[model samples]
Target: MTTLLEARGLTADRPGDEGPVRVLDSVDLALESGTLTELVGPSGAGKTTLLLALARLLPDARGSLALDGVPAEEIDIPAWRMRVALLPQRPTMFAGTVAENLRVPWRLGVRSAESPPDDTALREALDRAGLSGVALERGATRLSVGQAARVALLRVLLTRPRVLLLDEPDASLDDASAEQVRRFTAEFVSGGGAAVRVSHARSDDAADRRVRLTGGRLEEVGRA
Candidate 1:
């Protein structure tokens, strides 16, 4: 598989009320196209930090990141972000309806170059996420956490990002919804998409590699 994303000496820190504290240290990783990589570790082990770094969303991040063999900095921030979509652990929705939220990608200049997914595609994504009851016209705020997560994921998927950085996407999902997530991720990789999923729990989803962190450092590197 071609390398879609790569990081070397990835490090990050958090600025709290007290001061800046280190959260990640010298993390080296690569994400290959057509594969899923699971980032597994204990809580506060920097899993989310790593994911944000991969998506170039962290202000405290200090490291080298490349996309398709090109330095990420060379790419426009907006374009880079759209290509490497990061789904936060707690996804927020717009004040408008679900359909309105789904239409946001088209409103962005960075993403407008690519045609937005049609209503049929959006509805199919929602259905696959087991959210058929979430009418597009329904207020986004009315969604449950699990439903919101799915909706957020579907929104990202509609953008056709080259890489997906998901933070514990299944943490709030029920068994049925979780199954849908697993299936969608698996199929995504199988169809030449790349993704990094942050999860502490071991799941049945297929991943090409496992990157483990402990105490804010790379601890184990294994294949799945």
Candidate 2:
């Protein structure tokens, strides 16, 4: 498969009371189309930082990143973001009905109506994310943490991004919900897109290649 995303010598740091604290250093990674890769690490190991950098949400230090054979910096940020979607560990939902929140992107004109997915597509996406269409018409603020996460995932899927970046998406789910997340991720990649997941679960089934990050560096972990 062809490479969908690549990062070379990526690094990040932030100002601290002591000095600059390095979050990521000399990180190199490549993700292929139609594959799901996992970045595993302990807390504060820069897994999220790496994901943000790859999504073009954070600027890296002294490295190059490319998406779909084009330099990341050369692409329009908003367009790049449309192609690469990020689902943060804590997703924010607007104060409205779940369907309203799901339709927020559309209402904001972020997505064009000509290509709008049908109701069945939306329902299927919600179902695959372990949510029912009923939740769509309910109040978003009333959803449990896991339900919120599922809604976030479904919302991103509606955008039809070519690359999906997930940060600990299963952290708040039960076993059954987690399994549904795993299945949906697998199916997403199987459909010719790519995903990079940051997970701590020992038995995650969504990754094909796994890498471990430690002390600001990354090393390949065995196959998933």
Candidate 3:
């Protein structure tokens, strides 16, 4: 498989009372096309920090980041984020209907060049996310935690990001809903994209690779 994203010597720091605290230490990772990589670590192990840095959302992070062999600095931040999206642990829903929320990505200047998904496509995606009964006109803010998480995932998918930085997507979901998320992730990678999932459950038997972070450092865990 082709290397879709690569990071070397990645580092990040957060302000502490005494001084800047190291959150990520000289980490290196490679995500390939058509693969899912599971990132496991104890809480506060900097797993989320690494994903933020890779998505260029961490201002205190520094290192070499590349996409498809092109240096990250060479790409615009909005463009880079559009290609490499980070879905936060807590799903966020805007104050609007589901259709409006799903269309939010298209409203952004970064997505101005791309056409938004049609209502039919939106409905189809919702169905795939196990939300067929949820009307597109339903208020997004009224969704339950699990429903919101799936909606958030669907929203990101509609943007067609080349890479997915999933932060505990199944944290609030029930067993069935969590399985739906797993299926979506598997399909995403099989369809030529790549993903890095932060998870604690030992349900990543299908992952192409697994890595664990300890005290801000990373080490390989197992192969497919």
Candidate 4:
């Protein structure tokens, strides 16, 4: 398979009272098309930071990131963002109805207006995320965190990004909800898509490769 994403000598640092605080140091990763990779680590291990960097959501720091064999900096930010979507650990939802929140990405220009996904596709995506059509009419603030997470997943799916970045996506879910997320993620990658997920959950089966980050470095742990 072709390489969809690659990071070389990636490093990130933040200003501290005394000096620069290094979060990542010479971290490297490669993700192929149609694969799901997991990034597992303890808190503050730079898992989320790496995801952000790969998605081009983070400001320019050090090293290089390439998407579809092209350097990240060479692509337009908005266009790159459309090709790469990130679902943070705590995803934000609008105050409107569930459907409205799901539609926000399309309405905001992530997807082309000329070829928007149909209602059937949207409903199917929600169903795959373990949600029913009733969720569409419900108020976003009224749904529980787990439901919101599923809705967020559906929202991202609607955009059909080639590369997906998820950060602790299953953190607030119950057993059944987590299983739903796993199944959805698996199906997403099965369809010639690529994903990198950051999670501490040991039970997730969506990832084909597992990586561990510690002390500002990343190392491979397992391969599926």
Candidate 5:
């Protein structure tokens, strides 16, 4: 498999009342194309910190990150973020209709040149995310937690990121809804995208690799 994203000596720190708290300790990770990597660890184990470091979203994170073998320093941050999208646990809904919220990516500088998705395309994406009943004109803020999570996921999918950084995407979902989330993740991997998902539940879904984080250190648990 081709290496889609690589990280070496990744380190991160968080702000505390006393001083900076070390969250990650020189962690290294590599993501390959057409694979989904499951990240599991106890609470406060820095699993989410690692994902944030990988996505270059943490201001205190320091490391060497490369995408498709290109050094991160050479690539613009916005461009890198566009290719490597990070979806947090809490879904953020803009103050607008569903269609408008999904169209946010196109309005960003990174996707400015790309043609925005039509209503037909949006509806199809919603259907795939198990949100077909949601109307495009419906107020995005009114969606239930589960519904909002799927919509946020669909919003990320519409951007067509190469590497997806998902932080507990299925935590708020029920069994049926969680299954749909897993299916969407599988489809993304099968389509040649790489994903690093932080999941607490034991997944029956297929994943190429499993990594565990403990005390800011990473250990390989197994591989498919």
Candidate 6:
């Protein structure tokens, strides 16, 4: 498989009361097309920092980041983001109907209408996320925690980015909803996309690789 993203000597830190708090330390990792890499770590292990660094969302991050052999800095922020999106742990929903929330990306014109999924396509995506029978015309704010997470995942899928950076997407989900998320990720990688999931779950579907972090450091790597 071709490498979709790569990082080397990636390091990061944030301000602390006493001084600087080391978050990520000399981390090295790679994400390939058609693969799912699970990132596991204890709390405060800098997993979020690492993902933010890869997404170029961290200003204090230092090191090299590349996408498809191209330096990330060389790619325009907007274009790069379109290709690589970060699905935060906390799903954000606009104050509107579910359909309106999903359509916001298209309405903003940042994403091409011809590329995004149409109404039927959106419903299918929703169904795949265990949101089948969901009324798109209903208020988005009415969705529960798990439903909101799944909806957020579906929304991102509409953009069809090459890579997904998920931060504990199933944290607030039930067993069935979590399984839906797992299946969604599997199908995504099977379809030529890649994903890096930051999860605390003890077990999950077979992953191509497991990147484990300890005390903000790369402790070990478990390969399939």
Give TM per candidate: 0.92, 0.92, 0.97, 0.93, 0.96, 0.94
Of 4 and 6, the candidate ranking higher by lDDT: 6
Compose the digit string of candidate 6's lDDT tens values, residues 1-224: 99999999899989989999988888888899999999998888889888888888998898899999999879988788888889998999999988777876676556764555578877877877778878888799999988889888888877789999999988888899888889988988999998999989645666788889887778547878
Off by over 4 Å in 2: 59-62, 112-115
Flag regions of model 4 displaced more than 4 Å.
Answer: 110-115
Assess each prediction's global lDDT (C-alpha) against the native.
0.84, 0.83, 0.92, 0.84, 0.90, 0.85
Candidate 4 TM-score to native: 0.93
Error of 1 at 152 (Å): 0.6
Pairs that collide in candidate 1 are none
TM-score of 3: 0.97
Q: Which one wins on TM-score? A: 3
Instruction: Give the least accurate 10-residue stretch of model 1, judged by summed lDDT.
Output: 199-208
lDDT (tens digit, per residue) of candidate 3 on 1-224: 99999999998988889998898899999999999999999988888899999999999688899999999989989989999989999999999999999999999888898899999999999998999999999999999999999999999988889999999999888998999999999999999898999997645777999999997799999888
Between candidates 1 and 2, the one scoring higher on lDDT is 1
| Collision pairs in model 2 | 99-136
Pairs of colliding residues, candidate 6: none
**Per-residue accuracy of model 1 over 97-212 as CA lDDT, tens digit each:** 89889878888777666777778887887887788888988999999887887888888877788998889888878877777778878877787879999876645548788778
RMSD to native, candidate 3: 1.0
Model 4 residue 51 CA deviation (Å) reads 0.7
Candidate 1 error regions (>4 Å)? 16-19
Q: After superposition, how far is residue 28 of candidate 5 from its true place, in Å?
A: 0.8
4 or 5, greater by lDDT: 5
Q: Across residues 1-224, which tens digit of lDDT does each residue of candidate 4 receive?
A: 99988899999886778998788899999989889998988988888888888877766569998888999779888888888889989968898987788888777654655466666776777777778745567898888889888888878877888999988888988988888888878888999889888888654665789999997799999998
